[model samples]
Target chain A: MSQDTLFDKVWDLHKVSSLPGGSDQIFIGLHLIHEVTSPQAFGALKDKNLKVKFPERTVATVDHIVPTDNQSRPFKDNLAEQMIETLEKNCLEHKIRFFNIGSGNQGIVHVVAPELGLTQPGMSIACGDSHTSTHGAFGSIAFGIGTSQVRDVLATQTIAMNKLKVRQIWCDNKLSNGVYAKDLVLHIISKLGVKAGVGFAYEFSGPAIDELSMEERMTICNMSIEGGARCGYINPDEKTFSYIKNKLCAPKNEHWDKALTWWKSLKSNENSIYDDVIKLDASKVEPTVTWGITPGQSISINQQIPLLDDLAPNDKLVAKEAYEYMSFKPGQLIKDTPIDVCFIGSCTNGRISDLRVAAKVLKDKKVSKNVKAFVVPGSEKVATEAKQEGIDQIFKDSGFQWREPGCSMCLAMNSDKLIGNQVSASSSNRNFKGRQGSPSGRTLLMSPAMVAAAAINGKVSDVREFIN
Target chain B: MRSKFTPPIGKISNINGQCISLIGNDIDTDRIIPARFLKCVNFDSLGEYVFEDDRKTLKGKHPFDLEENKNSSILVVNSNFGCGSSREHAPQALIRWGIKAILGESFADIFYSNCIAIGIPCFTLPKNSIEEIQKYCHNQFLFLEIDLKKSLAKSKYLNFNLEIKESSRKMFLSGEWDATATLLANTSLVEKKFKELPYIQFCNDN
Candidate 1:
């Protein structure tokens, strides 16, 4: 047990009761719902004839099914239209606040919650979306749940959860200029393997992590689910407190100082015990990219795809499957593989900073004629900010479509999708087969700048070369 | 909107059914109920589309589509079963498709928990025992008797103890599988705890 880790402290604080079977009745402070996963949960509520126990604790947003290209009412996809409409009706009926399509606060649930300052330190947050861990950057214990769990949260404001073992993932040294948080997470996943964190909650700490911006820390926590951790979080600091202060849903007036004090104390103690601890040198990590279907199958831009003989016996099966599915040469340079589409958005890399970095790379540089590139802001607020900074124009000038915010092409629930065997360089999380639309489509996951680098060169190229 | 009917939550300590073995490692939730099927109007009728893509692509050769495997209630899987995306529909689809229980070498954390909440138990047997069970499934009409209370599974060719966690097994036995009721049972305590938080209390004051 990692005594006094941020995760442990948060988990202990939120624990309402211990059930007879080694599970805690954990109270959820914030419940985020999206159109894709919430309709069923709402339906479940109707079926069982139950009302939302703590409606105020829940927030609704439409992302996974909303169209990024069109903002017209009555969406083109009948299913998408029905789903959003259902969400609207559910929110209205339940009196839960919803950030709809045109709402300035509207965006991906993960992005919306934090930007609104609803995601705070020491809160136990649950969402029907896997990337819910994105909230963990503020020192919250956040994890993704299923619709049934969503239903559980809706009806009770709490979920019965088994306490998780804690693993302290220490990131040493500051990352070099060109490398981003997305690359750092990918590098961590590649070393840990996807299933390594199955029964544990990862507490990411140490000097390098402490140096990251809130959004950068968010990028790292966002993909903690990829490594199979139930949840992941970084302890709150001055940076965390400052990022959370004075926002729409954040504490105001007299409560501000009191809230700040509580958040400050939420950090782990000096000598905390951990079930396990893993260390990574951030300085050594490069702008990394996934070479296969799984997030764990990745290599640095300067490295080559691993040969079959180089893999462990158990790993060879998936590696062989990856080599076949990706159609890349076993020992080919990871930088040489060409890409057809370049998408730089999703909960993982859809924030303003991610857009700024990608825009910086795309500035004055045209996207390759062979590549289809686009930038989708994580939220409407991020989109507004990017437009203010003129980042969208830079993307447009570079031949990339500057689109509205929604989880576009991330899971491909909307019109944006890969056609046939078109491969993509995406800044979104998850490179699972058919993850970006077409059943045969392949996705290479990397940071926004790396995706921009690939878009300009029409191949998997090193972002370091593109950066000043 | 079509008002479909869903079966009441199941409560049984033992389930005996013919097994449908999906013998693969890291068999993800996407493959179980592909992302396309997740956009349902409701979760009630998702069972028909469970493994929709697999059934469509592998058609006659797919186990779920096989005449013999139809109505099979027990599913046997290899390591890391239900690994990706925390889609409750994966378990909802499985339960709806007539799967009452799942036995495997290992199970992903989310998938395992989701299974419990929906009244489906994800039991982990030893690796070799799981292998024996998978091998046994090849036989015609290979029915398995899984006793939840005893944590044992038996068939004509194999008999082994399953490693169902004490907490999870107790959940099934004590009828505490549905967490909603248990959580609702402690409403006052939850409210008391919520008010204690300075941040939340401040928001309410506004």
Candidate 2:
């Protein structure tokens, strides 16, 4: 009855053809590809005697399998080399632009797009990586696709998708100091549990969301996939406009005002109804950490591990499994757990601000001798900015190894990995078992500053303790 | 090993009972089984780790674990069930956990496909209906009527639509998710196609 929301407008505008299978062929506005997933997809295309339909719609970069440190040619790992070569060959064959290592542009796909101003509001962006929703921070409807879907996008510049209902997640009030977007999201996920956003698109709103920087908003929207939403986005605002203001793909000066006018018009109207609505208080959020294997199995840094008796009877079994796998004692303080390594990078929190925050903590302190600490930039652009600010020097001086940009140690697609059963304080998402590359590796999810503190203490030390 | 897909052999039991409500959001595959156990290509051993984080006693209290819900082929989950990464192992592990079907408000795209790729039937019910089902199940006995042949499920809790891809639905309804389709269709064509590849020829020459 009311005018359609931005989600509805974008979805209807992009609807190409509806198939009998109850799915719509939605035209993709922008397609992003990285090294690991694109290679196999391109190979599949080659096997099928196909070429990318619109190369211009697609952008390429090497991530997932690039080394953070010592990224020399013909990498020591054969599989890594093969993946890069295959991507190079595929991009060359298809005329797709590739941001390769040392290209001064190569970095995580999510990081490079924003820096280059490629990600704009009100666009449909798809990538072969799950964190593709990271682009949604700019008010775009972005999603991660599988290799087959990747091929589908490459072959047709479209994907078959079902429409998701809109869910407005309203966060009122300003966040206090020491609380970050990561903490806010962790709190939201914890409150919503793990399945609340099913069949829905979350429109993050309210004053707190409006005040966050574009990068901070990116961190919030990036993990929407973790909350089970098809995709999540914020309405395009002045902040969104300013973030994309004069870069590669953004509209020029005259067109900028026109774009803003149209973008502002796309916001959900007052009294607009949603299929679901979840409310949160911004000031209540604190630095959060995952005590169990799942993101939902998380607690505030000050809390102790939840004992089995504290959970529902049905949930106790899972609690026990987590306790066993994590080798953590029930009722023990999570902050005291020792860490063997500390990794700060991912599409999630690998931005320049994240580095600066960690650098601020590491300005005078040194990392523990037992901890293997490294800092990976999200993109080459972020790397350049970090260098310009001398943040890299600060990290190096604090014993944090400065490495090349890629999805290093996040999911362990690159040379960076944990050796064995080492527990790591990681800023990346998903602290699942062996997720950091080592078969027996352990990951403790936290903020970049928390990772820095852990690196210095070789334990799960709270960032607030060292903040002063 | 060029292993063929085998449809798991089990008795078909109608879970016409009231829904055992599972409430949560953004339930990821890692939480389902954790990434550590994914090293085993076969799902046999990893099935025990299903919901290992939430159902903590999976290792010690084997039969008491939620994995024990294995005997009950039907799973009733909350909204946004199976969100996060596009890992096929998520559904594979669920199937191995003896979940023949899942009823939820919604599922992650990749997770939904992974369920269909195997023989699992995932049906979506409206929220009101699911809530009603939960209420009914709590108060009295309720069971769902599932007719694989009719490709429809009926229950007091959920009467909403469950959309499945044409090819995938056909394969799942007929229990042909494994090599049945491949074997029933044609193998010689694939072999002949394989013969044309230089890589295959190189192997033969070697």
Error of 1 at A295 (Å): 0.6
Model 2, docking class: incorrect
In model 1, what is the error at residue B147, expressed in angstroms? 0.6
Error in Å for residue A65 of model 1: 0.4
TM-score for every candidate vs. truth?
Answer: 0.97, 0.78
Query: What's the lDDT of the predicted structure labeled candidate 1?
Result: 0.86
Q: What are the DockQ scores of the candidates, in order?
A: 0.57, 0.10
TM-score of candidate 1's chain B against its reference? 0.90
DockQ of 1: 0.57
- Model 1 per-residue lDDT at A336: 65
TM-score of model 1 (CA atoms): 0.97
Residues A107-204, model 2: lDDT tens digits: 88989988877787777889877788888888788877766567777877776666778888999997877778887887787677555665677789
Q: Write the per-residue lDDT of candidate 2 for residues B54-154, one digit (tens) a residue.
A: 55533554321533233455566656667677655567666565566787767776677556545677777776655665565445544567665555667
